[model samples]
Target: ENNKHVNDTENTLKRQKTNKKGGPKRDEVWEYFIVDDEKNDRHYPATYYHCEKKWQKGKLRTLKAHLSNECLQCPENISKFWRDKLSTELTNYTRKQKTIIQLPLKQYQITQHFSSDKPLPLAITERIDRSLLKAW
Candidate 1:
């Protein structure tokens, strides 16, 4: 019984040390953003903003200050946000098409070439070529 108690104590200590070494969990960190009422009052890391230009233009204010000042809803700010959002969306869409759609199609064509299979239809090849050139 004494040996069993010692083993249980050792196990408890090991668990405590492991938990301490790992520090707070991911949910604890993310919960600061979602649950903390004062979160907006604190400074955030630099990568939080999507638009560098707008971020640079605005004086560094707490999130609460920005919201209270109506900066987020201002016409100029709204336009900037939309412009940045659209540009990012367009870039992502183009990249997805090129990599996911065009790349696989190109790979298939290459495989056909190696197998001495009939080449891809001329129209498809032409379209892919045009897109590749346009990307450049």
Candidate 2:
């Protein structure tokens, strides 16, 4: 039936939108995280990443940690790109003067006390900072 054909076409289009080259396309601005490297046969299981800007080559595990902790120290071009983007977004948000809801002073103090009992991990803190920067 024509209706069945239409349904199949729509489904194909939806799948195409979600997938590219057999992998789902990531929506995030940064895609530096390492996946399995399929290029070189010699390093089948070993991980690696190439930094074109600095002409530096590194292993995936080490590079992932370094990128997460010291994104600002990445190759100059990449670092500058992120810095400019964040700065512009922050400047625009500050200029807007949007009203942010605030917790009462007493409630904030109590919450702080509970939070102080357990420190957040460095990775978690870094993730939170990145989320905020992206949101801004």
Clashing pairs for model 2 are: none
Q: Among these predicted structures, which one has the highest lDDT?
A: 2
Task: Give the Cα RMSD of candidate 1.
Answer: 20.8
Q: Compared with the true structure, what per-residue lDDT tens digits does model 2 show for residues 40-81?
A: 632213221233222123344344444444554466665565
Clashes of each: 0, 0
**Residues 55-83, candidate 1, lDDT per residue (tens digit)?**
32222334323333434443465446545
Whole-model lDDT values for every prediction = 0.42, 0.49
| Cα displacement (Å) at residue 136, model 2 | 57
- True lDDT of residue 33, candidate 1: 20
Model 2 misplaced regions, further than 4 Å: 1-28, 35-69, 94-136
RMSD of each: 20.8, 22.9
Candidate 2 at residue 67, lDDT? 49
